[model samples]
Target: MKVIAFGASTSSTSINKALATYTAGLVDGAEVKVLNISDYSVPMFSEDLEKEIGQAEGAQAFLRDLADADALVISYAEHNGHYPAAFKNLFDWATRIDREVFKNKPAVYLSTSPGPGGAQSVLAAAVGSAPFFAGNVKASLSVPNFYDVFDLEAGQVKDDAVNAQLKEAVAKLA
Candidate 1:
């Protein structure tokens, strides 16, 4: 399987990015491609901007990446209980190019945060919106208290329960 994983964040030290990368790596025998939201920078979407610029090369490339994937692993970072502006902007641009942005690709969705809520609000939002964009969500996982559960240097989940849940979720990808 060609698996594409990304954190819906632009932060240099995004816990969600680490989680996505770790989870994607767990899918046995799959070729994984990790994307950084900052690398696909598109001008913030607006009708006026669309009129001024027909389409952005960055957005086109981003969509092409999604199109090439057989499966997707996305971990969203919540900012103020919502998606970060960087991700939302890229999403908006991609959607304009094609309504079915996810291309019906099976996906494992995940989220994490420093707090107990574990960015669940944003995960819920993604779950609710994904179908419209043809995201075939197979499983979802949320890791609460990210700092306590994940070991950044080791690149693994330290909490047994969370680790088990993540394993089950990644299994669905296979």
Candidate 2:
């Protein structure tokens, strides 16, 4: 399987990005492509901007990447209990080009945070609304207290129970 993975955040040191890349690596025998959303930067979305620049190249390119994927693993970073502004802006532009940005690919949604909330608010929203955007959600997980469960130096999940759950969730893609 060709799995495309990304963390929906623009932070250079985004923990969500690390989590997404690590989770994508769990898919046995799959070729994984991890994207850095900051690389596909687009100016904030607006009707006026859309009228001025039709479809932004960044959005189109991002959508094309999604089109090429057999499946996706996305980890969302929550800001004020919702999506980060950068991701939401890119998504808005992508939707203008292709409403089905996920391109009907099966997807696994993930989220995490240093706090106990686990960024569940955004994860739940992503999983819940995925179908409307042609995201075939196979499974979803929210890892709470990211710093505790993830070992930055080891570059993997350290908590056994969370690791097991992540493995199980990713396995559903098969």
* The candidate that achieves the highest lDDT relative to the unseen native structure: 2
Model 1 C-alpha lDDT per residue in residues 1-174, reported as the tens digit of each score: 999999999999999999999999888899999999899979879999998998877889999998889899999999999999988998898889898999888899999999999999999999999989998999998888999999999999888998888888988976
Runs in model 2 lying further than 4 Å from the true structure: none
lDDT of the candidates, in the order given = 0.92, 0.93
Judged by TM-score, which candidate is best? 2
**lDDT for position 132 in model 1:** 92
User: Per-residue alpha-carbon lDDT of model 2 for 1-174, expressed as tens digits?
Assistant: 999999999998899999999999999999999999988968889999899989999998999888888889999999999999999999999989988889778889999999999999999999888988988999999999999999998889999999999999899988
TM-scores for all candidates: the values are: 0.97, 0.98
TM-score of 2: 0.98
Kindly state the number of residue pairs that clash in model 1: 0
**Candidate 2 — which pairs collide?**
none
